[model samples]
Structures are given as C-alpha cells and as structure tokens.
Target: MSPTTRASRRRRPAAVTIHDVAARAGVSVATVSRVLNRKTPVREETSRQVLEVARSLRYVPNVAARSLSIRRSHTIGIVLPEVHGDFFSEVIRGIDLAARRAGYHILVSGSHSDRNEMLEVLAAMRGRVDGLIVMSPDVALSALHDQLADQLPLVLLNSVAEGHTAITIDNYGGAHAMMRHLGTLGHSRIAFIKGPDRNADASERLRGYRHAMRQIGGRAADLEVPGEFSEESGYAAAGSILARHERPTAIFAANDAMAVGVLSAVAAQGLNVPADMAVVGFDDIPIARYLAPPLTTVKVDIAELGRRSFEAVIDRIDRGLPDQPRHECIPTSLVVRQSCGAATSLRRTKKASGKKKTTRQEEI
Candidate 1:
C-alpha cells in the first residue's frame, strides 16, 4: 500500500476485540475468556499477561454478548418508595459501594409510595436486572407477590413480604427504647408526631409508642397528631400540640426531618428545646447531630441497611432463591443529645433532693 493510503487506514481506528487481546497475549481465546470473566480459575501469571495485553491493546469485552451467554445482566434493580432526602441518599450510597465491589451495576427508581407506580416500575425492570431490592412500605404483601410471579430474586428493604428475603430496621424496638428513655427523664403525657398511616415503619413506631405508654399507665390517644414525615408537617403538628388546652412537655417526631421541623416550631413559639419542651425524633440522619441542640433520636444505620440488602439480593442471585425466606431486622439504638433534656432532668432531680443520683451520661 502507498504511504498515504496506510496513514488514512491508521486514522480510521477499528474497535479492538477479544481476538486481538488473545493474539497479542499469545494465549488461546478460551484462556483469555476464562481470565476476563473470572468465572473459572486460570494460572495467575497467565491471567496477568492476558489482562496486561488487553489493557495495552485497549480491548473491551462485549458485555451484552457475555450477559446473554451467562443469562445474567450482572445488574441489580433498586426500587425505593422515594429517592429523595438524606435517608434515601445514604441507602443508595451503601448499595452503590457494595455493587461496585462485586463488579455489578445498579438501576434505581422511585415509586412515590404508590402501588400502581411500584408495579409499573417493576414491570419495566423485567429482564433488565439479575435481582431486585424493593422498598415499598405502603403496599400490601399479597399485591407484591401476585405481580412478581416470575420468581425473580428479590430482597425487601424496610418492607415485609412472605417467601422472600427481607431486611428491615427495628422500628418498633427503636421507638420503644426512645419512649423508655423519655419516661426515665420524667416525660409523661408526651405528644407524638406520627407519619403517614399506610407506611409500615410509621405504624410500627406508633405501635411501640402506644405499647410503652400503656405500660406506664399513660394515655396515648389524646396526645397524638398526624404528620406526613416532613419538616413542615412536623411544624404544623407541633403548633397544634402547643395550642392544646393541655400541652405536652415533650414531642417525638417519626423521623429526623420532622424533628427538625419541631425544633423550628418550638423556637418560633419562643420556647427553648429540652428546657421548655423537650424534642426527640427517629432515624438519626447526618444533620441530626449538627442541629443547634443536637437531636436526641433513634439511630438507624441507613447505609448499612442498604449494604445488607444488596448483599442479600446478590446472594439470592448466585444461589437460587431459598426454599425458606430469610428475614433480617437491623437493631436500633437511642442517641441521647442536648435536645432530650436528660441531663437537665438529672440536674433538677439532684438539686431538688440534695442528693446526686447516677444516670447514664448523655451522648454528644
């Protein structure tokens, strides 16, 4: 060929293929395939040589072809109620990290906590993922099972569905513990800002509060106010609670967002937190610790929950679905801070009685 013709051919770079990599590495195509897929073990030195040659040649594997051959997409689908706010972000972060470590990708979608929307998203994900992680607290388990008839590997996050693996936070235990802490600090007749009625987590937390109240011989029905698990709703609920003929000395919000709203509402009313009206919340989001009087809240490791859910679904994908479903509930703990007035309550008790009583030191 003429020099000019050769230069033109070089300018039109052709896509490098596995064949080129194998040829340059002086290995059979099967050896190169085994090394690249990592499905079957190969000699370490040979594997390194194949990888180095592929990198040097800028050879890329055809993921679509490989997925077709293996009958796996090597991707996980995550369907969450809503992908907004710190909680969801943390969960996504955890899943993404785990997925990357396992050489898998993730597809995320939001269902807006609506059954129809969730079904639609699940339908769209068919054949596009190897497994799924779903978080639909408001939907019925029966409805979900009916729609997922394909028996695709699934992991439920913060949800419950029989015959499927699930990873959920201990919403009831967390709320109950918080209530006990408040009661220890002498906070009876505490007002509760409840989340949406249909949400599972919200219902569990409310149940915990009610059970604890009954245990202490306190009335719960009268001091409860409805909220949407939002800051604005918490603010509105707090305002209504404060205007009551018999105001509560403490308010417990369902989540950190609402707790922030309660704090703002309390300040707007010229009330000091913990001193005038103690405040506490569930789900210790990142910002909770940085709040002015740092929030007292239930600590749920949101990211760890995500990581575990990812691991569970991947496990199902590798080893087909188990005959018996696995149900895992992550525990929660109380993180006491300035907002709950535990320290203040202790100080008052000591001064009034002229005797120092031992109490757990407050958590920063």
Candidate 2:
C-alpha cells in the first residue's frame, strides 16, 4: 500500500455490521439477532462464539432498528424535579439497578422544578420509552392527567396524582414524631425550617410540625420559618431565628440538605450544637452520619422508594393492568444522634433540677 492509500483508509469510518459478526461466527444473521435478543435459546457453544466474534469486531446493535422490529424500546424514562442531591442520586442508583435487571435502559431528564421544562421533556420522550418514573413535586396533577392521558405508563415518586401509580414517604408522620420527641426532650422552643412551599412533602411536614407544636402547647405560627429545601434557604432561616430576641433551643429542618445549612449558620454565629442550640432533619442522607455531631434525622429508604417505583411502572407496562392499586406509602423512622442531644441534654436538665430541689430543701 502507498502513502496515499494509507491516508484514505485512515479517513474512512470502519463501521462494524451484524452480518460481518454472523459471518465471522459461522452463523446466519437471524441466529445472531435471536441470540442477542434472547428471543430463543441457541446452543451454548454457538451463542458464546457469536458473542465473542461480535465483541472482537466491536459491533454495536442499532437499538432504534431493534425497537422498530419489536415495537418496544426497552428503555425507561426518569423525570425528576432536580438531580443534584444525595436523595435523587440514591433514587437513580436504585432505578438503574432494577432497570438493568429487567434488561431495560434509562433515559433521565431533570426539569429543575419548571413545569414547562417537564412538559417538554415528557413530550420528547413520547415514542422513545416504554414507561416513565416521574418525580415532579411542583408540577400539578391536573396537568399530568391532561398531558399524559392514556399515553404512556407512568409511576409517580414523591408526588400525588389521581389515578396514577405513586410511591411516597410518610413526611407528615415523620415530622410529627420528630417534633413530639423534641418536646419530650425539653425542647419546647423549637423552630421548623420548611422546604419549598409548593412541594407536597413540604406542606405535609409543615402541617405535622404545626400539629405537633400545638400538642406541646407552643404557638406554631411564631416558630415556623420558610425554606426552599436548599442549603441557602436553611442558612437564611437559621439566621432569621438567631436574629430574634428569643432564639429557639432547637431547630428542625424539613430535609437533610437544609439541615446542613442550619449547621453552617449556627457555626457562623459561634454557637455549639445541642449546647447553644440543637438541630434535627429529615431524610438521613449519607452526610448526616458524618457531620460533626452526627445529625438526628428521619430515615427514608430513598433508594428502595426508587426501586419500587420502577417495578410498579414496569408492572403497569408489561401486565397492562389498569385496575391495579396505584398508591403506596414508604414508611420513615426516627434516628436519634448527638445533634439533638436528646439523651445527654435531658439527663443534664433532670440532674440540675434535682440539685436545685436539694439545695432549696436544705435551706428550708
């Protein structure tokens, strides 16, 4: 070969085809396709040889063409409000695990809490996916019903939509329990840092905090602080609480992300956790355990929630059962840690009270 021939050959795209793989493996293209699709079992040795040859040739199958032939994409679409945090990351990991086990791929898109963006993402996925796992807290159920009406199978995660399969956490119960626990620990002056106002989970948590506050004989309206489920919002809420003439002895953020912010704010004020102030949060994200005081929080199995959501959507898609029950609630549990100082502070309070009573009795 001459220099000119070598240059032309280098520029040419060496595309590998299934027919080439089949020929190299001494099999028909149909046999190769069947082996790849698992449509029918092939002899073990023959299947191994075919796969080996395909890998040697660096052959890639056309999923689009396969979908055209089979009328199924074998892809699941995941739509989320945001995709930056540990919560969403864990959910995606679980979804990926289940999807791969079911021999399906995932197409993930984040709308960043924008309704129009979510609609656009859904529209783009119209004919490209077999089912969807949607986690849109700000989007309305009416819009979802109108837009996706009988179009594609969908499972809602952390959302409430009528007539759709959903997997959600026990936000209200978890928050209520945390508040009641704080009360039992002598934290009557507790403040709540809320999530986004439009979020369903945030609303439920806020309601829980208020109800629990009333049970403890505290005024809910005065202690509530607004947050957007972001660290910045939590920091801002903490600052607002600190600026008050009377600061709360403890603060509970709606989520772990915001609770982290509260920690930063408290540190900035040169205050110590549980001594100067106590802190607690929901969603025991990985960092919660590693924090300086090891934050107290409500634990929701976020990854499990995602796995169940994908399984539910897959069932709806494969079984074609519209009458199946569509709603599920994942439970949450309280995890007590040093951040709230429920154990140490309560002991100290009781000890100090006992000492005071003893001193008064001796004087009498």
Summarize candidate 2's per-residue lDDT along 53-99 as a digit string, tens digits.
99988889977777998888999999998776788888999999999
lDDT string for model 1 (51-79, tens) is 99999987888788788988889999999
Best by lDDT: 1
Q: Judged by lDDT against the true structure, how good is candidate 1?
A: 0.86
Positional deviation of 77 in candidate 1, in angstroms? 0.6
Give the local distance difference test score of model 2: 0.83
Least lDDT summed over 10 consecutive residues: which range in candidate 1?
348-357
Question: What C-alpha lDDT do the candidate models reach, one value each?
Answer: 0.86, 0.83
In candidate 2, which residue pairs get closer than 3 Å at backbone N, Cα or C atoms, i.e. clash? none
Flag regions of model 1 displaced more than 4 Å.
1-14, 25-27, 38-49, 344-361
Best-performing candidate as measured by TM-score:
1
